[model samples]
Target: MAKVTLTNMCMIYDKENNKVLVQDRIKSWKGISFPGGHVEDGESLIDSTIREVKEETGLTVSNLESCGVIYWFNNETGEKYFVFQYRTEEFSGELLHKTDEGSNFWVDLEELSNLHFAEGMDERLSMFLEKEYSEGFGSWNQHQPGKLQFQ
Candidate 1:
């Protein structure tokens, strides 16, 4: 049987400074991405997104705008995963000293695409910034490790 998993990611932006909080992921996957995590069994997607953001960045986010769901498929084995994407500029809390997930820091919007990111993150970030609060939906498939085919 093929396995499926649900995950969440949020792009917390500082509209005034044109920056966004990103995590430098070093485990399970490498490269920079937004702060987020797996959606536990029975957890609502919005709740999961809020919880993950707080746990990773110590910021309680609100006014979340759903960017859409990314359906990831392993074309060879038929395994799949779904990632719920979100963006929020409204949050309150002091940034934490550290998080187990990785190093968290603010990156300027203009420079985000230049950073080394996990797979398709750069594209996603660009889409969010370009739309300027518009909703986005997309999908991709992988036939081999480290090779992503987006449609």
Candidate 2:
């Protein structure tokens, strides 16, 4: 079977800052990452994101939109897979410093570059936070050995 991985549609909505939330990944985490994780077997991507947020930040999302995905190499494990992106224009919940994954926080959009991040994260997250962003989702066929195509 072809090795396929499911990317969780993760996001952070902070009405307090009027900016998307981001966290400085700690412990075993690769780097600062948005709040999310992989989709469990038989679980839907949308459900995965919402569940992850609850388990990570105690937030509740009423709606989330799939924005995009990124195919890239991971330096640590040398693992490469597509990462699904999602954003919520509406949500409700309180933030707390709790998660088995990493310490969570709200990173200002303008100051996103201040923190270190995993490869390809900045490019993808920036798009998710964009107002005019549309398209950039679905399967990415290998056009070349090291190339990725998104639809």
Q: Which candidate leads in lDDT?
A: 1
Model 1 per-residue lDDT tens digits across residues 34-147: 888899999999999999999988999998888766676766666678778888999889987567778888988888888899877766664456554333333345534443
Q: Write the per-residue lDDT of candidate 2 for residues 51-126, one digit (tens) a residue.
A: 8777777878767877766655544444556566788757777886756667777767677777788544654555
Q: Give stretches of model 2 more than 4 Å off.
A: 27-29, 72-80, 131-151
**What lDDT does the true structure give each of the candidates?**
0.79, 0.66
| Backbone clash numbers for all candidates listed | 0, 0
TM-scores, in order shown? Answer: 0.84, 0.72
